[model samples]
Target: MRSPAAGVPDPTSAALWGLPLWLWVVLGGIGLFGVFQVYYWVGHRLGSRLYASRLGRRLGQDNIRRVENAVRRWGALAVYGCFWVPGLRHTLPWTAGVLRISYPWYVVASALGCLTWVPVTSFGLYSMIWGWLRLAARSPALAAGVAVVVVAAVAVLVLRRRRRRRREAERRPEDTLTTA
Candidate 1:
């Protein structure tokens, strides 16, 4: 793949002020953290109405209720765990707000979750981008082939994992013992 910038070979080198690209990545992640905090605040303010909206109904009242129960049971830890899950990320914070988790606890949990999530995401992105740039520089065709293979492998693995989980779920009832 060709670099977007004609003259500039390495887009990563493009930076604001004197700071390196990775610093900016970290800052962006922190910014996302702040945005999510505000998102949580909105959920806090909206409370039940937010959950009663069309989108919320789509998310399923039972599901939201389950999340609410999880929040009540686990407190900040539920927020932390759900922060890493893709679909649940947005909902978890809002649920935390509806549960009226302490402001300080929410902040601490958010900070801790972001600390783990942001750095890993930034590093993974940096690595993948650089790896692709290097591969494409050597041979664009090879890079494209490699990208396809990686995506296919990931898809297969996810499908297999889901199938295995479904099988386990199916067997659970039969696996239980019955009293005479």
Candidate 2:
């Protein structure tokens, strides 16, 4: 909102902390891309042993299998799509490396994903936080209510997902036994 001597609006006036919002978004995107590269290399180095590692066990075999299937089916395109999927974003990169998908294609897809996804999420999150702050300034009680509602919604979603996973786990053994 502030302007310099030349009457041009200062970009840093809208910044979070000392850096501009655009700078933060760019850094975040670059950082995420770098992490993806590391995941790919580690998976490539581990090869099949990745599935037996501590991190892999933590991720669970079922999750790995699902990621593997995505990579197998979609190849490089899966890398871009994964950016939009919370769970698959981290897992699919590793699987792609293990499967040895073309590095050049993988780089292109991941870069494109970073370019598109980062700006949208960054601006959206920025708007949400600033809007909440402005609302809080106007009415403390209303802001508190909004916060509580958002938390409750997230909690409900998490609980439902956990219950569904538990039920599926319980049924898996029965399904295997019946087939056998």
Ten contiguous residues minimizing lDDT sum, candidate 2 = 171-180
* Candidate 2 structure quality by residue, lDDT tens digits, 1-180: 745574433545668788888999999999999998988888788897987776776566777888889898898899999999998888889888898998999999999999999999988887688779878988999999999999999999999989987777676653222223
Tens digits of per-residue lDDT for model 1, 23-74: 8877976887897798689888999898877767656666688888988999
- Root-mean-square deviation of each candidate, in angstroms? 8.5, 5.0
Predict model 2's lDDT versus the native.
0.84
Best candidate according to TM-score: 2
Model 1 Cα RMSD, 1 decimal: 8.5
What are the clashing pairs of model 2? none
Q: Highest lDDT: which candidate? A: 2
Candidate 1 Cα misplacement greater than 4 A, ranges: 1-19, 150-180
